[model samples]
Target: MTAIGIYGSAGRMGRAIATIVETEGADVAGGVDAGGDPTALAHDADVLVDFSTPAALESHLAAAVAARTPIVIGTTGLNATHHALIDRAAGSVAVLQTGNTSLGVTLLSILVREAAQRLGPEWDIEIVEMHHRHKVDAPSGTALLLGESAAQGRGTTLGEERVDSRAGLVGARTEGTIGFASLRGGSVVGDHMVVFAGEGERIELGHRGEDRTIFARGAVKAAMWLADKPAGRYGMTEVLGL
Candidate 1:
């Protein structure tokens, strides 16, 4: 059985993943939380699954590389520096990272990409997302993931096309640029919708996360799938063979 070690073991996602791990017939090798020893945990398991905070990402990657263990990162709110670290770690160990791990969301990203590709540049794209009030990031990572997909279909990068906020005198929606809106509320898991608007027609694609366990289950699935893969950086799309 695959032995999966978890980072941020004290958090909700860490606990959820542990339950799913056992249900899936895998061994819960161990876990490490804040100030915990990740290098030792990595050495003890076949793979590492991180639902930890962005602040913990660097040490976790170091530990995973040090132990030559594959790792699945479900941590959100990561910036360019964090991704740079992940890219470096991927050179030495199999590393899979994603904004959202729910299989439904993974497939939704694919559909959004296809829709963007099929539609014309006249079709303006907008992404809207909502999460629990306690969640910190605006334009959640999943929103950005969907934006990236749409941009890919349009033959552009999200960096160039993404417009995450708008204020007074923001002007008309740019022809091909992707827009984002973020909402926060009580006890919400996650919700994302992508709208493609044109002159008279509209297409919207979305995924609603009803529970956190879906993410945990997917993370476990990804960790197991990544355990034996060769060193590389990967995404949920690769995990699902999409």
Candidate 2:
């Protein structure tokens, strides 16, 4: 049986992954939360899954590399520096990082890219997402993930095409730009919809998270799939063979 370690074991996603591990026929070798010994946990497990804060990601990645163990990162609210760290770690150990780990969200991303690719720039693209009130990040990671997909379809990058904010006097929506709007409210697990507006018709692609288990299950599946892989960066698409 695969022995998995959980970082950020006290958080909701951490707890969820722990519960699903055994059901998937894997063993929870150990877990570490804030201020805990990550190096020890990494050394003891065959693979590691992180849903921890971005503040601690560097240390966790270092531990994974030192132990030569694979890690799956589902942590949200990350910035460019964190991605660079993941890229660096991937050189020494297998690393799979994603905005969201739910398989449904992964498929939705694929579809969003395809739609944007086929549609013309006249079809203004907009992305909207809603998560629980407790969530702190604006334009939730999943929202950005979808934006990246649409940008990819247009043969551009999200950094160049993404427009996360628009206020008064934001005169007119720019053509070919991908817009984002984030909503927060009570108990919403997650919801994302991408809209492509044209002259007479519009296309919408979306995904709703009714529960957290799907993400937990998907993270576990990624961890299992990554355990024996060679050092490199990966994503859920590779996990699902998409």
Candidate 3:
């Protein structure tokens, strides 16, 4: 039985992960929130699943490293420093990080890449995503990841050429530009669409997450897969073998 520890147990995603683990016949060793000692919780488990905030990610990664626990991180909105920490931890323990954990989303990314590669610069790429009203981040990590996929397909870097949310007086969409838009409302689980628009036609690759449990289930699967790996960094693409 895999002993799983959950960080940010009080949050929506964390609780969902715990429930999924239980339903999947895994052991819920323990969990930690802002009010608890995450290091101690991780120390007693074989693997840790983190669905916390960007601010809390560093401490969670540090705790996992200290305990020599393999971790599956599903948090988004991470900065460069956070990535550095994850990379350092991967030197000591397996670390699986993903912007989106839905298996369908991973497949969508793969298709988006293929579309971007085949469509050429004449077909402009745009990513649009929507989440619940409570979400804090804009554009979303998923949107950015999708943009990165498109950029990779175009043999470019997302950071070097991202055009996020055109505002008033924006003349026109630039050629070879990747754009992003975000929407938040109601209790939307998640929705993402990548549009490839040309002169007279449009192609859309999309994924709708009707249930949050899909993400939780994917995270659990990733944890199980990471448990047997040597110290290294991985992603959902690796998990899904895409």
Estimated TM-score for each candidate: 0.98, 0.98, 0.97
Shift in Å, residue 128, candidate 1: 0.5
C-alpha RMSD (angstroms) for model 1: 0.8
Q: Cα deviation of 221 in candidate 2 (Å)?
A: 0.4
Clashing pairs in 1: none
Cα TM-score of candidate 1: 0.98
Structure candidate 3, residue pairs in collision? none
Which run of 10 residues does model 1 get worst, by summed lDDT?
Answer: 165-174
TM-score of 3: 0.97
Model 1: CA > 4 A from native: none
> What does candidate 1's lDDT look like per residue over 1-242, in tens digits?
99999998889899999888989779999999998889899999999999889999999999999999999999999999999999999999999999999999999999999999999689999999999999988889899999999999889999998898788998877788999999999989999999999889888888899989999999999999999999999999998897
Q: Could you give the candidate ranking by lDDT, starting with the highest? A: 2, 1, 3
The reply for model 2, stretches above 4 Å from the true place, is none
